[model samples]
Target: MVQNPARRTALADAAIEVLAREGARGLTFRAVDVQAGVPKGTASNYFSNRDHLLDQTARYIHERLTPDPVMIAELLRAPRDRDLVKALVRDIFRRISEDRAGYVALLELRLEATRRPELRARLTEAVRDELDANVAYHLGQGLPGDRETVVVLYLAMTGLILEQLTLPEVLGTDGLTALIDAIVERIVPAA
Candidate 1:
């Protein structure tokens, strides 16, 4: 079907909102229909099933969460300075803070991935691609290790994000900044 960009964007936003507010259990055609202000069966017409809806929602969240081109270019071009890394880390934390609901939806998707192998594979590949990109950028700055280091750091960042999401005040801006500083100090210390 030829979908209007505005309509598709609205439906996608509504899906994310529903998934965030209600988790996987709360996601339904009716709820999305209400959220999107579309008639019943509209969402189903676009997304044949709940799995399809969730998959698209996951993809949307991933795109929203992934680092942007400007940041990627900065990371690629900038020197291996500890301050630069810290700044990047702080920006990352800020973005996560701004999109708490999306992060929560992603967490729900991660759990669901475990039970569904196909979803799990997709999730794994997505994570791996992200890590590879970051690893390549860091390597460009003369960081050590190969794919393994990138994977480990990616996992570590995920853990940090989860902690921030669960305990935002505890991992407040200052605390998270300090944590990132420490990580940068360890990984890319000043000369």
Candidate 2:
């Protein structure tokens, strides 16, 4: 079968929605096909099996959530300081909140990885690469924090994003922005 990157991506994006709305157990080819509004068996036509479909879903989430280039350029032009740190982190969290479905799917993917070593390795590499890329981006922009700080900040923010997305009541209502500020203040601080 001929490869159609666009179609494949559409299916994977739909799978992300399914993974978020229904979770790991709800992620099925038929669900994806239905969510994507494609004919039955369309997902199978592109993906060999569930693993392939899920791997593609992870890729889709990564691509979808990457920091926007235009926004990055704007950040680069700004002075390197804690204010910039807050701006970058706030922007990231804003995007995360906006794409709650994709992030929820990612959470589900993380849970699924524990039972599937292949997925574990794949997600681990992807997250590591993302961290490295983030560190590079910060350095290129002369932003605060070294690679080590960025790694720690990433881990911290991961937990925050999880709670903020899934169990907001745990963190309380309408205070995530302040939480992000506190996290940045402790981790990166005023440059």
Candidate 3:
């Protein structure tokens, strides 16, 4: 209900940090206020309730994680082939690694969503939209993959990211890159 966009975004961003550091249980309005360095009750003013805060924070994280259009355009200038697909997927992992907190908070939201139907519905919708967009982009670019290929890569990347985040020692840096290359090589047909 707050009309101040910047202030609302700041509150939502703070809520993400709280969710990342403290999990969903620790993401209270007061926690967000402290994280944002704002007056007490400031978060409460911006978010009608905890659900509202979580919803906005989820959206904010997605927006933050979106690749820059300029970067995407630059990548597109290269030939659309298996190598390009690997590069694109590699860029995705790089972005996720760069925003480790955002991804962790997203995982927390997934756990919270399992217990909250409304949040689950919203996340489901968001996930579906992202999947659809990826399929569309891959097809439109004439990339070496169909929808199913893209879907498989999505699942593979999801698993890789999960392992990288929770068990970094399992994959390490070199293993991660090797796995990405292997997935792309096996999944995307050679052009």
Clashes of each: 0, 0, 0
lDDT digits (tens) for residues 62-125 of candidate 3: 9989998999899989999999999899999999999998999999999999999999999999
Tell me the tens digit of each residue's lDDT in model 1 across 80-149. Answer: 5556666777777778778888888888888888888888888888767766778887677665545565
- Full ranking by TM-score: 3, 2, 1
> lDDT of candidate 2?
0.88
- Candidate-wise lDDT, in order: 0.76, 0.88, 0.92
Instruction: Rate residue 125 of model 2 by lDDT.
Output: 96
Model 3 residue runs over 4 Å out of place are: none
- Show where candidate 1 strays beyond 4 Å: 71-78, 141-149, 169-173, 189-191
Q: Best by TM-score, which number?
A: 3
Q: Candidate 1 vs candidate 3: which has greater lDDT?
A: 3
Model 1: per-residue Cα lDDT at residue 62: 77
- CA displacement after TM-score superposition, residue 129 of candidate 3 (Å): 1.2
